[model samples]
Target: METIRYGPEPSQLAELTRPSGRPKGVVVVIHGGFWRSRYDLSLGRPLAASLAAEGWAAWNVEYRRVGNGGGWPGTFDDIAAAIDALADVDDLDTGSVLTLGHSAGGHLAVWAAGRARLAGPPWGRPRVAVTGAVSQAGVLDLAAAHDANLGTGAVQDFMGGSRDDRYRLADPAAMIPLDVPVRCIHGTEDDVVPLSQSTGYVERAVRAGADAELTEVAGDHFVLIDPASAAWARTLQILTALG
Candidate 1:
């Protein structure tokens, strides 16, 4: 594994891992911490290493979170810069790029894939297009998260507001019909994020004519990211199918 910088800030970095032989593609792993400083990229290191061992180049990205130089546009900006930086990586197939994010990272993964649809001066264009995305126990629906008060007002803290526009911009559910294929996997017993977040987003995405679907697994929130768990096996199955 090698650490590479995508921007000036220390948080704007990613850990790159290459397999023994030619890789199928690159997988961008985004960690979950409810978009807070307390949780860093450490949560994603294990997953990145595992992907590398499975013959995939894994770019585990770290971005500024709430309490740091993150929140709102800053967090969004960091994610955009980190994913785009992969274009500069040598000997890698960016055309087959995929994003796998857990929890809050899941929201960003799906959001980043749909960035091309955003209006204005293109806040940030990914140099390498994202072909597909997987959200593992993600808070996909910002409005639902805010309404349920997940993480004790985490949605408001991350978005910096409770306005409708704020929710619309940050909510992955609202940004449905993304061009790329998106799969959301959630644990049936996940109390932290809830299965509804994934199911709700998939429902909306399908209704909007997006290639989206939801898979329900057994276990709680952490099991989805735990390598030894059945939930993780299901995740790997989905990822391998993508390839």
Candidate 2:
């Protein structure tokens, strides 16, 4: 694993794990911790290592969380920089970049994929585009999550306040028809994040003519991130098929 800095900030870094042979593509692994500072990039390390073993260059990214220097556009900016930084990595196949994010990271993964749709946004244009995405029990619907208070006001904290006009740009659910294929995998028994997050997002995406689908497995929220769990195995299969 090689550590690279996309920005001068301590959190504006990412760990790159490359396969021995030429990589099929790059997979940006974004961790999920309700977008809080307590949850760092470690949550993505295992998935990054696993992707490397499967012949994909894994870019495990770290961005400022709420408690840190991240909130609203700041967090979004870091994600954009980290992904665009892939352009500087030699021998990496930037043509087919995909995203794998769990929970809050899942939201970022899908949101980053749709950055192309944002017009005159604060994050700016995307260089390395996302071709596909896999959301592991992600908080796809910001409004729904906010209304339910799923993360105990996590959505509010992430947005930095109540759901306002900014939600049109910030919420993954609102940024539908991502144009790229997306597969949302959720645990049926997920207590941390309801299964509806993925299901509702997929439903909206499909209705909007995007290639999206939902898969439900039996496990809690964390099972999807556990490499040893069947849920993770299924996630790997989904990612392999997408790749």
Candidate 3:
């Protein structure tokens, strides 16, 4: 595992793990902590390592979260920079990059994939081209999350405001019909992020003519990120199928 810095800030770092032999592709892992500073990139280390062992170059990225110089546009900016930084890496297959995010990270992953259409002063344009994305129990629908007050109003806190233009621009559901294929996997028993988030988003994406699908598993939220969990194995299968 090699720690690479995408920006000067400590939060703008990613752990890169190369496969034992030639990598099949690159997998960008994004951790979920409800977009808070209390949670760091460590949550994604296990998944990155697992992907590396499976012959895929995994890049586990970290970004500024709420309460750590992160809110609204800052958090978005950090994610954009971290993903785009992949262009600087060597010997990695940039053409076939896939992003996997859990929880709030799942939101960012889908959002990052659709950054090309984001409109606002803060969101310019993302240079990284994501070929595919997987959201594991992702908080994909910001408006619904805000209404339901998931994570004690985490959506409001991350957006730094209520449902407004900024919230709409940052929302993965609102930015649907992304060019790439999106697969949303959620545990039916997930209490943290409900199944509606995945189903709702995929419904909208399909209506918008995007290639989106929802896969339901039998587990909870954390199981999606646990390397030893059956959910994790299913996730691996999904990633393998992405090729």
* Best lDDT among the predictions, by candidate number: 2
Question: Which residue pairs in model 2 clash with each other?
Answer: none
Task: List pairs with backbone clashes in candidate 3.
Answer: none
| Count of clashes, each model | 0, 0, 0
Looking at model 3, residue 54 earns an lDDT score of 91
lDDT of each: 0.88, 0.91, 0.89
Off by over 4 Å in 3: 119-124
lDDT of candidate 2 over 32-123, digit per residue (tens): 99999999999889988888888999999999999998989899999999999999988777989999999999999999989889986565
Question: Ranking by lDDT, best first?
Answer: 2, 3, 1
Give the poorly placed runs of model 1, Cα more than 4 Å off.
120-124
Give the per-residue Cα lDDT of candidate 2 at 58: 94
Report the number of the highest-TM-score candidate. 2
Sorted by TM-score, highest first, which candidate order results?
A: 2, 1, 3
TM-score of each model, in listed order: 0.97, 0.98, 0.96
